[model samples]
Target: MRRIRVAAAQMGPIQKAETREQVVARMIALMDDAAGKGADFIVYPELALTTFFPRWYHADRAEADHWFEAQMPGPQTQPLFDRAREHGMAMSFGYAELTPDGHHFNTSILVDKSGAIIGKYRKIHLPGHDEYDEERAFQHLEKRYFEPGDLGFPVWRMLGGIFGMCICNDRRWPETYRVMGLQGVEMVVLGFNTPSVNSQKGEEGIEQRMFHHRLSLQAGAYQNATWVVAVAKAGSEDGHHLMGGTMIVDPDGFIVAQLGHEDDGVLVHDCDLDATRFGKETIFDFARHRRIAHYGLITGRVGAEPPPEE
Candidate 1:
């Protein structure tokens, strides 16, 4: 198996009170730590720049996108790229993208060792209710704030390996990984800002939080035979507590690296890209096992009307 070293940069959120410049500095520090630890690439969690703002309802769209970065490699974040270039480190990070085309998305950017933008992934799975639910504990206004990702699942070759990115909720879906797996992706880098409690579902505290986190990543890794590096903006920020437990899974689904406390930290792992080849050629071989011909309904349209009365 060909090897590639990686670091999962796990940290808690920047409270709504904090500024973007301060958060970007924090991210740079994490990149330095990962590079200091001999890692070739570092992965940071979603919305790493600001507090999880979608929890509270906002009437103005501009205010909602205030935390979103209008452009990549723009002001306040160029330092991260420059530092990565100087240190010969590559990084993957998730952020709220305020696209110039007039859409906002929870997106991830892949940067190579030379600080080149290799790829960008817009989150496809958007969670939370469209309107505020008063009975719930906390509000999740992601659907209210962001448009669903327009870009379908994509895999990119960079930093000496093939990689893919998906935000937190997207990990819950199997097709998220299957699509990239079909492309022979060797690794997947993803981030999340998941709260420790689920307000909308009306369940016990913390029951499904960790379960969904680990289960999704594990199954994705095992089923697709790819390395999964999932970092989280964990710990209690503001009044709410976000789940911590940042982790990395190997090609065979083993939890190779994990962070316990969720405070700003890094988990370094030696990942072998070649390890995935064995699985792709054997158990999960798409060329030999995928029966696309039988799954017609996947492409079939389930019309609500009776075929226009034909």
Candidate 2:
């Protein structure tokens, strides 16, 4: 069976004021760390370029623009590409994207060892409020600031295997993995910035939130029989606490590598992509087990729980 080495880079808070150069430098350092350990691929947290700005109350367009990156290989982040190319390593990082047509999105990019941009995935699941709710302590205005991800979940041929990507909230949905699984994806990369508490519920939310995080990843990996590499940009940012549980899950629903803290850290795992076959053939074999019909949830149109009536 063949294997691939992967690194899940867990990083602490990044100040919104931090320049692109600073963020890129941080990413390069992680890349170097992974490369030194002979990792073939590195995965960084969602919005790895800047602080979690969706938490703040912002009315100014300019300020919002300041926090968004216009072009990926543009001036500020070119060094990241140059460095990865020089090291002959592949990487995936998440960021806020300002599209050429004036659309703003939460997005992630995949770069090959040659530094060529292989694929881009816009986050599909936009969480939080569309309108300001001053009653809450903090804001999760992702829906208010950014447009819903236009590009549906997609899989690509990369790094000698089938690859796919998803953002924080997207990873929570089973369909996110199913989309890629249909393509016979061998590996999935995801980045997250999950908060420590649910704004409405409070501390009881912690266990459930953390459970959902691991649950989705584990279930997704096991169901799809694909390697799951999940990284986090965790810790307190803007006076709000966040959760950090970076982990690498094998196709068999087992955690191969994990990091406990929400800080600057790297967890490396020697992944056998071929190991996916063991689960795929035995447990998650779609051709042998998946029932496409009789499950009314998938093809339903309204997405509103099917009217609650049989």
Candidate 3:
């Protein structure tokens, strides 16, 4: 029974006025709580350190440089590494990354119990448009701010199991999980900063949005036969609300533990890596069931094509 006690650390929100120092302090407080709860691993939400800045647009894209972290542990974030080392807890979190060569990506990292970064995944499925559109209720300039991830969905062996990482919109795509699932992933940890309402459709409120969130995670978990720990940076951010449904899903896609409110909190559960074996060896055994030849369209084409009129 290879078991890992994981904690879904759901954050309340980070206002634009909040400094990295203040945000790190909040993360540390959650770490303290998780450690006390006997959690050996902790997952924090996407854009964990800052308010989701892509919501705002800058005429000069360079003006948003202040929001990007040129280095993962650059001064303000080093304490998180130190605390993880102190608690000997493996952790994962997301942030906006600015490369030295001037590339930007929405990224997440996985650290081992020793506080060493073992793997990194840039978000491939970036949502929203690059150009500002009056049609949107609010701007989501992710395409303009960050390039799509160059690093593919890579998995790493850690904590006695194979683990994978994805961020926000990446979770909404099946390919994100399937790629790692092919690598025999036993666990997938992800973070999200999702708006409570659809920016384009006013009728699509929190209820529908939350339903999709659960549908994505649950389906991904069950189909892949892996445990999924999803954390959220929730509540109101500068008057724009982000939904919180931080949860831990089992191999059968059942949510074993979930956060109740859109607030700073942690949900811990013992996830036995062995739980994945049954489904993986049976129902979801890709080697025995998947027919790749018939799936060419998934990768062969990008946009949909319709049949010609008779």
Candidate 4:
């Protein structure tokens, strides 16, 4: 039985005034709780070490860089790693990354039980605009602060299954899951910080926002026949409300575990990795069912164009 106990470590608001050390300490406390619950793996939300800074626009580069880490497991994050190693717990978490070359990316890293970095995935589908719009309630300047991720969707063999990682907006893209699905992924872990209100969809309500989040995750899990562990950085941050519906979905797309509160909490569940086999080999079998030849537009076309000649 390839069973692994996992936890969706949902975080509450990280106040704008909070420091990285304070946030890491809070994460460690959540890790302690997950460990006590016998969880083998814990998934944390995107930008785990800071508030959702992208909600506000920063004119100065130095101000924006403050939210980014110069190195993985850097000084502020090393304690979390140390604690994970001590407890023999594997973890996946997200953060803003600043490369040595000064480029920045929204990144997530997977750490094995031994506290070794096993895989890393940078967020590819960046949402929002670069320029700030005064008419909007708040700014989502991710495009201005982060460069498009250079790393493609990749899967790694870890914790007795094929694991893949994606961050925030990447969860909304079908291509993100399909790439990993094609790689035979058995599980996909993701972190998100979605606001309850979006400027692009100003008329939409919070119910719709949460519904879309779950819909995307459920669809991705069922289509790929993979377990999905999605964590959220939710609640109001400096008066800005964010949605929190952290959940764990089975290979059949049913939510087996979910957090009910918009606060710091953990939802633990024992997931059987082998549960994916039945679906993979039957109705959803990619090898036997997928018609790649008919998907030429997905692979070849860049923008809207005419259909292929008959």
TM-score leader? 3
| TM-score of each model, paired residue for residue | 0.94, 0.95, 0.99, 0.97
For candidate 2, give the lDDT.
Answer: 0.87
**Candidate 3 lDDT over residue span 1-310, tens digit each:** 9999998999998999999999999999999999999999999999999999999999999999899999988899999999999999999999999999999999999999998999999999999999889999998899999999999999999999999999988888999999999999999999999999899998999999989999999999999999999999999999999999999999999989998998899999999999999999999999999999999999999999998999
Worst lDDT run of 10 residues, candidate 4, spans 55-64
User: What lDDT does model 4 reach?
Assistant: 0.92
lDDT of 2 at 230: 95
12 Cα displacement, candidate 1 (Å) = 1.7
Model 3 is weakest, by summed lDDT over 10 consecutive residues, at: 257-266
Model 3, runs deviating above 4 Å: none
Alpha-carbon local distance difference test for all models: 0.87, 0.87, 0.95, 0.92
Off by over 4 Å in 2: 60-62, 305-310
- On lDDT, the candidate that comes out on top is 3
lDDT tens digits by residue: candidate 1, 193-286:
8888778665645657787778889999999999999999987788878888689988788888898886898999899898888888899999
Report RMSD (Å) for each prediction in the order shown. Answer: 3.1, 1.7, 0.7, 1.8
Q: What is the Cα-based lDDT of residue 24 in candidate 3?
A: 95
Query: Which candidate would rank higher by lDDT, 1 or 3?
Result: 3
What is the lDDT, from 0 to 100, of the residue 74 in candidate 3?
A: 85
